[model samples]
Target: MDTEAVNNARHGLRLLLVTLLLTSIGFFIYYVYRQALPKPLPGIPCDEVAAKKVLGSLPSMFSHWKQHGVVMPWLTGHNLKHNPPLVQFFGAPFAQPTVILSDFQESQDILLRRGKECDRADRTLQSFEGMIPHHHLAMRTNGPRFKGNKELVRYLMSPKFLHEASAVQIYEKSLALIDLWSLKVKTSGGKPFPARQDIFDAALDMVSGAAFGFKDDLSITKRQLNHFLSNGVKFKEHENGSVDFHGFLFFGYIVAGHETTSSSLSWALKFIADHQTEQDKLRQALWEAFPDAAAEKRVPNVKITTTHVPYLDGIIDECMRLETSQTKITVGSWSVDDMHLFKPERWLKTGDSGELVYDS
Candidate 1:
């Protein structure tokens, strides 16, 4: 009786062990498969050659997209156009996943609506961190540090402060710029100079003062900032077990603040020059508004307020709309989200009406 009972119990124990082992094996296999599967690189070409070409083409693409919005057809071919237009590249190996975003609705969802569920895409933050430490205020979410920084910025950029700062900084700088441009004109006997330089000089001066202090001599600071922003620089270690979070704020301001604005102003001038009738109409509007030529000559002596030229303000707004300075903002994340480019029109949610919600 004892032998039979022991044998029966042993058989039962073996069966139970076999079942547990099989379950464990199944779970292990599932885990391994999940780990091995590639995360969706939204907006990235599935084809290797096309992805390579995309990385190769970014510098020119970044500039051209600002001038004339480009739809990345290769992305569509790869079934990668589901998200917004984007430009994805970093100083890393090609194995890195691409950056992507959806149209404004998605941006609103991610940035405003479902924002708590989202964070700035990881790889994009990493690239930026490598370039600009702690300067990524927008990417930091609503942390206390960011809160303090924002408060500081708000106080500094408050109406009274901005009014005074722009008076001392932008107005003076604008006069300096015109004086410099006049010198160039006189020296060259009215030969056309690339207006981009003037625009850059003006914007760089303006925003630098706006962001930092009016006293911070951004023109001198920008060169050093550029050097700091070169590719592959180390940033602070990321909180993740990964080393991706090195920061790069020092130079981020230079590029993120100035270049985009400068480009907008440059394109605005170019658009105006190319369309001389529009320019004349605007100039006449300006002349009528200012009225007194004697008083207007004091433009150099006084700050150029909004009251001085209503048409110029309208033109600036129109130019900003027609010529987007930043064509694509990159985003990469750890959640294996799809990466895609963002287009401007989709920014206003026009895609839903066109039945290209995903494709656009």
Candidate 2:
């Protein structure tokens, strides 16, 4: 071929490649933008009229925010007052109805009893990509595929694994957290303050160590584990969402360890902060569990386990309970007489032998 003809061909190929690249970037940008924001599936049977009155639009997003204000209170304070338990609809001509499960048994039946009903809507299949390839447990439909994922999770979470991993990574991170918080608390003159990001970072470190081996650059674990563990830490539980990056777009949700471990840590800290007694108990438990926890020039060398400190376990349980509105969404108008109230002590009761009751 002639030199001019070859040059022209090269130019054309380069131009084509540039066009494809630009188009790809544009598409990806739009996809990510759309994912982070909740959009209305207009035809979904929600109450559009009331939504408009509250938010001034048909496609209103009744997102989770301060689970207390947006959901729990509304469920207990408003919806429960209705005979059939009220539900709200979103969007116009075609609206999506929000199904509030006020009855715990009914929710359990739909989510746990009726297996197929619990499967992720097929619409979610598209979200299986990146670090979580299609076969990832979280992305699978409920059945054999999910079972395989469960088995994998079971192995990863075997007591031997968690206990070993906790000894190597988790407790180390916990100690690092103590140092970070000590400085922060000192800086704030020991006043109540926000430690969400720090907690997220600590959780992220543990998650990264769990998923990927520990890095010499420790904070990278915090950065990547943020995908699996923590996201939107600044947002209240109801308004909460994932913290995945653009590359993790398709892997919408993650299992830092189990379900929402990283975010749960933040909630745990928030709960502890709210209850000084619980916080003090936790501190005392920690000191007891690791006498060298505050030792200078040496990280506490302790093989810690939750069993050693019952109060610490109770604090975690209380944190999870209060997060129901944040995570579970209460339709408690059915069973729980008072779902909005936070009372962690109910989980504790003296047994006939004078031992504290423990039930899963």
Winning model by TM-score: 2
- Give me the runs in candidate 1 sitting further than 4 Å from their true place: 1-48, 51-96, 99-119, 127-132, 136-139, 142-144, 208-256, 293-303, 306-309, 326-360
Output the worst ten-in-a-row residue range by lDDT, candidate 1: 234-243
Worst 10 residues of 2 by lDDT: 232-241
Per-residue lDDT over 1-58 for candidate 1, one digit per residue giving the tens place of the 0 to 100 score: 9999999999999999999999999999877655443443665534344344424434
lDDT of 1 at 118: 72
Per-residue lDDT of candidate 2, residues 65-108 (tens digit): 34333444544433444445434433233323344545444655
User: Residue 209 of model 1: what lDDT?
Assistant: 66
Q: Each candidate's TM vs. the true structure?
A: 0.53, 0.59
lDDT of 2: 0.53
